[model samples]
Target: ITGELINIINSPDTSEDEHLLSVNFIQADTKGPEFKTTYNSTAQAIRIEFSTLELVLHQGVVLR
Candidate 1:
């Protein structure tokens, strides 16, 4: 699966800090458990949620 990064949002709150990343899958190919090559336009993209603390702990963080 290969996708293009669309957007990233960082929001920190007093209780929970999180990050959200949106990715659009331009190409996908699988042949192991299943065989698929294309996806519907609505299902071709997804949002990935993460914790801001996790990023900070990782040391270096770059978004480009």
Candidate 2:
């Protein structure tokens, strides 16, 4: 119930693995919603961002 949520970002347009990045340890629970990311791109760089809050109408448990 308490752990890290890992996100991996990759683009087929980029050939290098060094271009990849991730964000971790984001908190989530049944009582609250989950957060996600957005991507912004320019000619030189790609930016990833996470929001402060998310709204989920129902809380479901999934395990893999």
* TM-score for predicted model 2 compared with the true structure: 0.18
Q: Worst ten-residue run, lDDT, model 1? A: 55-64
Residue 5 in candidate 1 has what lDDT? 47
- State TM-scores per candidate: 0.19, 0.18
- Overall lDDT per candidate, in order of appearance: 0.39, 0.35
The per-residue C-alpha lDDT of model 1 at residue 1 equals 17
Candidate maximizing lDDT: 1
lDDT of 1 at 29: 39
Candidate 2: count of backbone clashes, pairs at least 3 residues apart or interchain = 0
What's model 1's lDDT at 9?
49
lDDT per residue as tens, model 1, 1-64: 1364433443555343323444434433343232343443232355555544322322223532
Count of steric clashes across candidates, in order: 0, 0
List per-candidate RMSD values in Å: 15.8, 19.7
